[model samples]
Target: MLKARVITAIFLLIGFLAALFLLSPLGWTLLATVVAMLAAWEWGGLMRLVGIQRIAVALLLGVPCTTLMLAQPEALGLSGSLDKGAALSLAWWFLLPALGFWTLLVPLWLVRRFPLSGTAFGLLTGAVVLLPTWLALVLLRHLGPWALLGIMALVWIADIAAYFTGRAFGRRKLAPQISPGKTWEGAYGAVAGVLIYGLAVYFLSGSALALPLLLLIPTLLVLTAVSIIGDLFESLLKRQAGIKDSSQLLPGHGGILDRIDSLTSTLPLVTLLWLVL
Candidate 1:
């Protein structure tokens, strides 16, 4: 299992890097759309929408992404027509609600253990979970592949730290019913890891995007918490749906959603910060 995971990680890293640096803006949008499509399919599986229902859900979410890209490439930083202000304004239409969903609704949903049922609600929830993420992927990459990479690395650093720290010193479960493995110790480790990573980037790059240590530390802490919520939310849904992984699409990695679950929650907020700050 470890070997399979390592190999898959290598290939995924290579492919992602190639796409990140090489793909045209439209190409990146298409690729992100494909990812969103597959994630939507897996999400449908979680919703117990089998066969045609799953495909329809995939199309329902995926097609509009492409349509929006084609109609308003400038809004995504794909082509230059609209100014940055206008483009950012358009992004808020999707991302503002996404911000609300992640920061407010998601925490409550997790605490209350709300049922993810009803076709209308399911679709709406999926849209809320997905579309901003798709937009974030495009906008962030456009902002600069390295910048996007650094933010993503923060999540990876946190997850890795949490995993090992949990194994070493975990005493209290973070969410025993939803995910048996996670613990509060792991959560603390995650925060510490991101703090170190944030500090390193701040002192090293000295970039304008690197908020001051005061602002940066708080933002990283909030993002770390938000990332955990995203992971747990998906875990809760899979448990409710009676599945282990979202899908077996990525060999040892499970699926795209499994890989990008944290990204789904973090990227939109990062993009919002990028625009506003």
Candidate 2:
């Protein structure tokens, strides 16, 4: 597992750098859409939409919907004058729906006794997971390579901090019912790591951000919290479906959804928050 994880990490790092630096905005958007589609496929399995017909339905609904919602900035009220920096900021703020999924869907799932068993439910869940992340990637490219690098750095810092903190001092579980390994200590570490990363971005970049550190601190906190929830949500879905990982697509990572579960939630929230504040 560790070897698989290392190999996967190396591949992801290389792929991320290439996508961020080398791709045009349209290229990035297309790549993000493809990734989201793969995630949607994993989600379909988790939701028990496994047959060819069900998977086809998911792809049919997901592809066009994601493209329309995430790729077309004009539909989302973004103007042509918006530079990469402004677009990235806006994208960070547009994550409200993804946040709403946790706020609304988790309770609904529990109250309804986790009624996410059907094909329709799976498709709905896939939409919720894929659309925001797709938009985030599209918007990241729109903001230019540096913005993409900055976002990836924040997520990487949080993930690394969480892993170390959880391993060293995770006495209290954060979500024992969903993900037994996660803990509050790890959560705090993740938030701190991202905040430190954001501070570095503030000093290093010439983006003319107002109250940059202040904005980044709260934003990073929110993103981290959202990221944890996203992970747990996927775990819960897998538990309900009686599976271990989302898929075997990424060897150690299980699947693309497993790899990007946190970003799926964080990116959209960051986008939306950037837009509003």
Best by lDDT: 1
Show where candidate 1 strays beyond 4 Å. Answer: none
Give one digit per residue, the lDDT tens place, for model 1 in 67-159: 888777778877753357856887888889999999999999988989889999999999999999998888888667888888899889889
lDDT of 2 by residue, 1-277 (tens): 8999899989988998887788665566667767777777777777676678646754764556455646655543243434545454544444565677865765466445464766666676677677777776676455568766667667767888998999998999887877788899999899888777777767776342234655656666777776776777778888888899888988787888777877777777666655555
* lDDT values for all models: 0.88, 0.70
The window of 10 residues in a row where model 2 has the poorest summed lDDT is: 75-84
Backbone clashes, each candidate = 0, 15
Worst 10 residues of 1 by lDDT: 78-87
